[model samples]
Target: MIKGKGYLKFSKSKNKIYVYLFGRLTGEEKKKNLFAFGRLENALENMYQIRESDRLPAELSELGFNFDDLDEWILALETRTTRNNKKINLPVIEERCFEDVTNYDLLGMSEKEVKSLNKDETFKMYSDLLEMIFGALAHIEELEEIEEG
Candidate 1:
């Protein structure tokens, strides 16, 4: 299942997380991020050389995401969209937000121009580039809040 359809599902989900985090899309549109997390757990299990844990802060930290952000990002995937009644929001994340996703190819795309794109297009470009940058593993996933806590 991790070959074709599974790959498609992971790609779509990775896009959802990126788009949702960027504040360009409605919370209603973000789907669950659990599938990616599950696959990660499986892959880690296979990596017998390295130990694994349900709390993902260490693994995610290695990816350069801050500890505090991990909880909120997971919520965007696995739990309610809003923290309270208010919308979960973000500043416009550009190449600065991620070291791995941005590249020389995007050096000419102004941050303003990028922020102006519609959510669908923004997500597409972000996910497409991320897939290119980190390949399929970028979509692997993180720990859910409860799982981490």
Candidate 2:
């Protein structure tokens, strides 16, 4: 099942999460983000090399996501396709947010944007973005259950 189905928002000030769904997304848009999300999930899996613990900081841990949950949620989002008669794995992601599926292209930052941030700044930004992604994953799981039930 497609989880989140769009863009997810996390409000730092209010400590709340929101999801904006793009129920009208085109096929190309969904395919693009699906690949993007798959890439992101693969990166995270490779970096951690383990998804059995809480990877968030003490403060952000309050957001209620653990690496394990995020891992499982992303696994649930996986879909299969065939390219050149070869079975390939992809994600089932939809474009439903303030912006289009381009939001899923986490690595789309320009060289200038990348260089402007020092290591610490970049890590902070990465952590914050991760928090949002985890929140989105949890929401997707819930939405999937809702749809199933």
Candidate 3:
């Protein structure tokens, strides 16, 4: 298990990955039962919308915390989480030579906006975002250096 942020864990084969609040909302500093928002995106989004006292820190990273930009990191996080949760794999041309992939909009994007995007546009967006994540992870060990230094 890859641990982060108190008791949060990410596994190479993690299924039903959740984001939970750990730590204190009250003035006391004892353990509190975790409140899971079911998914990281839901937790992060709601954590921002709700009072800070209602939750603990929900940063994108816990170890080292070397994020440069929150928004970019969030997009990368969402892309990674969504793809992982969906188990997205490289499209095999023969597997879909005669079938059409289902059309679906992003979870929170407005339907009108999604409707304006064609399959190519959606795929391009996914490709670019995922590439950004891969690039970022390539330098992930830098955060460890920051921590040790």
RMSD of each: 15.7, 16.7, 13.4
TM-score of 2: 0.30
Indicate which candidate wins on lDDT.
3
* lDDT per model vs. reference: 0.36, 0.38, 0.40
**Model 3 score (lDDT):** 0.40
Please state the error at residue 37 of candidate 3 in Å: 26
**Per-residue lDDT for 42-144 in model 2, tens only?**
4434323434353544422343435554444334333211222333322222212112324434646654565566646655555455567756766776897
**Tens-digit lDDT string for candidate 1 (56-102):** 44544443444344444444333224444444332233433343444
Kindly provide the TM-score of model 1 when superposed on the true structure, using C-alpha atoms. Answer: 0.26
Task: Find the 10 residues in a row with the least total lDDT in model 3.
Answer: 90-99
Worst 10 residues of 1 by lDDT: 1-10
- Put the candidates in lDDT order, highest first: 3, 2, 1
